[model samples]
Target: MEEERLVTQVTPKSEDFSRWYLDLIRRTELADYAPMKGMMVIRPYGYAIWENIQRLLDERIKASGHVNAYFPLFIPEGFLRKEMEHLQGFAPEVAWVTQGGADELEERLAVRPTSEAIIGFMYSKWVKSWRDLPVLINQWANVVRWEKVTRPFLRTTEFLWQEGHTVHETYDEAQAETLRILDMYRQFVETELAIPVLYGRKTEQEKFAGALATYAIEALMSDGKALQMGTSHNLGQHFARVFNIRFEDHNQSLQYAWQTSWGVSTRLIGALVMAHGDDSGLVFPPAVAPFQVVIIPISIGNWKENTLPRAVELRSRLERVGIRVFLDDRSEYTPGWKFSEWEMRGVPLRLEIGPRDVKNNQAVAVRRDNKEKLIVSLDGVEAKIKGILDGIQASLFDKALAFQKENTCQVSSYQEFKSVIENKRGFVQAFWCGSEECEARIKEETMATIRVIPLEEEKNQKGKCIFCQKEAGTLAVFARSY
Candidate 1:
């Protein structure tokens, strides 16, 4: 395993962050290249992390009165065309299926880039009265898009995600639902994943297809790039009208229902990796780490035989308290090698027990985030592990928040915006005229687009477009994103 020891082969963050990120993802055994050009295989370690994320998020969704359900993977050709804007937005990247069982099919089917169309059809049938309003359903599934460029979990040809669709009777209720889901996503990212996010609404041009308004939670990566972690859209009556989903009101009138759709994908795993990972490798928060604690027995001479028993006892103690703990008792690898391997996997806390420490009635606990080591007494080790995990979660969030604040900048001039984007590479807070033409021009010129318009637009700042200086309509966050 001499080759595995050569982990310090890349340039540091200050030198080349992109290369450093690619190296960390590959070295940590999180994912690997597959035979498909734009697709990658998520290894067990990476998938385990995703499973933790999914479990927590799924709990939140179910608690919010949403029911889990399954949707078809393929949508008929005409279904997508039900809404013109939706087809226009997704047409460029959709992969179509035109054959079945060695025979040519007359009509093509789209391997759902998103399930809005297919779900809309179901809503039309199930919703006959206002009492049937607010059909909240969520699906845990995989989606496909033929992307021209791909990056692991960030942008892949095929990815795993949960898509939620809901119908409401009133526009206000649907809008409220959209924001509620966005807040749920924001809280989950900040509290569970320990990544701070900026909650906001996307400009009309950046909003989701067929949505009246789109709400999103954006997080700043360590490299100064903004990542849209998740989004919720107020679809309004657009989809309801197209699908002819009319509900009979109490007043003996029929009206179109309001709708909402929201989702968070595996791409969030990529955000966690880039936002918190360091030179050592992944730095996972305790709340989402698959193994929060790993025990490595430090054996020396005759201590090898005697120390193994103490390590087992400590592992049992931790496991009893519901800590996801692992014992590294493999004799083939040295303690130092085991330490590095577990560190690379981002195990939150590691307990190293040796004959001397066991005799002293203590064990050395090391943190993965800061690499701080402390001798913790075995008497209340379970309580101590819980406290340490809490501290790790808070520290990770604080560190990420500080990075975001430092990288975020306010730009007034187009020249300043261009310079900051080219040099700094983070979120740029600027005023905009709220014109799609200006948005397109900025993207064409600097390759940066309006990521989101803040939900709480700064009062009294609505004055010229940041780029064109025409009248400033609203404040929008602009950035080059993944």
Candidate 2:
């Protein structure tokens, strides 16, 4: 039997958000540091959450006219070099496989940081006519980017992600697909993961390398830091032109196909933990929680025989209604211990069935978020669980939205923006001059960078540039990011 643990063992988030994040990850068995620097071994519990996210996201991807496909992980060095800008951007982090078993290879193969190089080459061969224009395919795979600094799932040397690559006949069609997938990503995170994001276009300095435009969903963590949730890029003809990904138009003229690539990585799990987790541990939204409900059978006297059977029955009922549940029937641990463990694991709902509760034909229901206890009658318990889970999902997104709103504010002066970036940190909305020189100078002076140019209502508001006193180019969100 394991020794009993105190809930307060996990670091308080307010005390130190980073330490608290690592503590909760270990406590919940989400991920652990690997011997290799900047690498992580995702525990089964963490992978389960990712699996649920994949299931939900894959469904949406298929519904939106995209299919799954896989490509080579090792790209020839020359392939990455084909696109000069793309090669330059990832050159610093590219891991090269120089040897093949015994003899030294003539050409080093790059472990793909992203598959655009090799994938675009394949598309060049596969696409011959306009009929093959819209190749909407997504691949769920792992990519390696040698990171000097790493954080568990957030910025690992290697991480699992889904990369979507598509080709279109015209610029307009490709641009539309880019935004379409962007909206899909936003909907998935907000509705399924229950993490609200700020949707906007990336500045030239921040956009993906070699991309004509890049759009992202930026989310604010509870610690007043911003995290890039996901990104969609309109590649235009950059890769297609470099790789000869051309197709014969209806007029029989060879034209370069417009392309797009977008992805969201395991870093999302870190975002979820940071956004919704409390001092106790992780608090997952019901949709992605490995176990939405945990059943604890109170073990006192012969309640094992009494409470265990009812707990099993409740698990069966909840499972029948599509609720992911775990029944803690282990006799070694006390019910209180199980409750605390599951609470730390962030099960949205806890149903405790004891001798008294079974006798009273009710179960003690506890919510993980607020730790609210309710005496739920045994009748229609499945429906009640479903409703509560739905409510929990909504409440999580709303709470995160409220937190983002509370932390975010518009600043008019460079002095005020610098102060917020240094002393107080959240999202500071400020005007930008749309100059790369200005952006770099600001980032060098203040660790905060322009997260995204707001495309919503604030983009229309006119104001002077926060730094240079020039005309406003666009409204931008500035923050130090993970």
Candidate 3:
């Protein structure tokens, strides 16, 4: 109760976006700074959101023929060195352990910045024949990266994520799997999280360390900044050759296994916070909300005997119908206080059952998104609750889609690009000559980078390069990102 009272108000988002974001996280009890500089402790409420996300996404992954597995967190220096490009890409961010029980070890073990090196070693052993062709496996685990600047979920030293690694016999099979996972990620993020995303291929400068190509889903935050939601990479035969993952093919010839790795991390939790949250606090989509409905019994006359019982019964009924509900029966907080508390916590639906309402067999249902209230009859309440939850999920996605549409624009020249990026922050679409030099120049002059290059069809539509004025071959979305 004291903690609830302590959360007064967040800084208005329009006044200060960063402060508003940090303030909402603290007041809403999502996560907090850890004793370590580049780490955070995700609180129960925040972890619950992640748990729901994991449950939903894992179902999709498993259904797509990927099995969950665990790999070692530490990779030997020798193992990482085998794949020099991958090692070099992650060298700066990799954490290392050199001592064991106060004794210096012979070889330093690197904390996984990503699990490709170690997973490749194991795949080399497990995949000796073509029969083990498409080995689709996913790991739900935490990884360590020594980040200089850290936010709670967005850029932590250690974070929870699901990384999928697969091995296929042919390049086409691997490519298909990579694109399929990319589409899968888009669907899961857009449907379950209720956050609209623009997805496509990453530029050469932006692709994963050793991947042949990388694809990602990028979402526009409320502040008009881009947040990469997920990525799927096609590793090709690079890792297979590096790790000696040779297999006998159908033609009885030894061939390297084509590979892929893809993942989405708890950074998504930060995206959800930035995308849909308002100055009030978090505004979680119904599908991923910890408790979709919170039942607050009005603490009026004889509430304990009348309203409380009714509220408890309603909670039971809702739970039976597979709805997550929380009945706040604590006598210390007033109904108004509970409403404010739950609103800040971002429960999609709030039900108020007062003694008078209980007598009339009705409850006041409040929506977190629009603050709309509906007098709902207790009879057949499950159907109404389900409908409202569905509506909230769709409405949140629609609102985010509208925001993205309003913020995005096409620039004909670098001047317009710089102006749009500086004066107004959002996505700026422009034709690129597919040159890393031009990409670096834009990032240097204006702090915006190429976020995504639209897939083949759209990218192939040519125009003059926005930066160089040369005939360009690709359409790319550029933005300042988190």
Error of 3 at 151 (Å): 0.8
Candidate 1 residue lDDT tens string, 1-482: 35344457544555688887777778777888889877888988889889999999999999999999999999998999999999999999899999999998899999999999999999999999999978999999999988998888899999999999999999999999999999999999999999999989888878898999898999999888889999999999999999998999889799999999999998988988888987677789998887999999987877556898888999999899988889998888999889988887789899999987989989999999998999999999899999999999999999999998998888889899999999998899888887888899999998898888888884566657887898886888899988
What is the Cα-based lDDT of residue 75 in candidate 2? 98
Sliding window of 10 residues with minimal summed lDDT for model 3: 1-10
Higher-scoring candidate on lDDT, 2 or 3: 3
What is residue 360's positional error in candidate 1, in angstroms? 1.3
Q: Give the per-residue lDDT of model 3 (tens digit) for 339-403.
A: 88898889999999997798899999999999899999999999999999999999999999999
lDDT of 3 at 469: 90
TM-score for each predicted model, relative to the true structure: 0.96, 0.97, 0.98
lDDT of each: 0.89, 0.91, 0.92
Model 2 superposed RMSD (Cα)? 2.2
Per-residue alpha-carbon lDDT of candidate 2 for residues 1-482, written as tens digits (9 for 90 to 100): 13223667777777888898998898789988889888889999999999998999999999999999999999999999999989989999999999999988899999999999999999999999999869999999999999898889899999999999999999999999999989999999999989989888998888898899999999999988899999999999999999999999999999999999999999999998999998777899999999999998889899867778899899999899888989888989887789888988989999998888999999999999888899999999889889988999999999999998988999998899988888878899888878888899999999898888766834466778888989975888999998
Q: Lowest-scoring 10 consecutive residues by lDDT in candidate 2?
A: 1-10
Error of 3 at 74 (Å): 0.8
- Model 1 RMSD, rounded to 1 decimal: 2.2
Task: Give the better candidate number (1 or 2) by lDDT.
Answer: 2
Candidate 3: global Cα-lDDT?
0.92
Candidate 1: the clashing residue pairs are 464-472
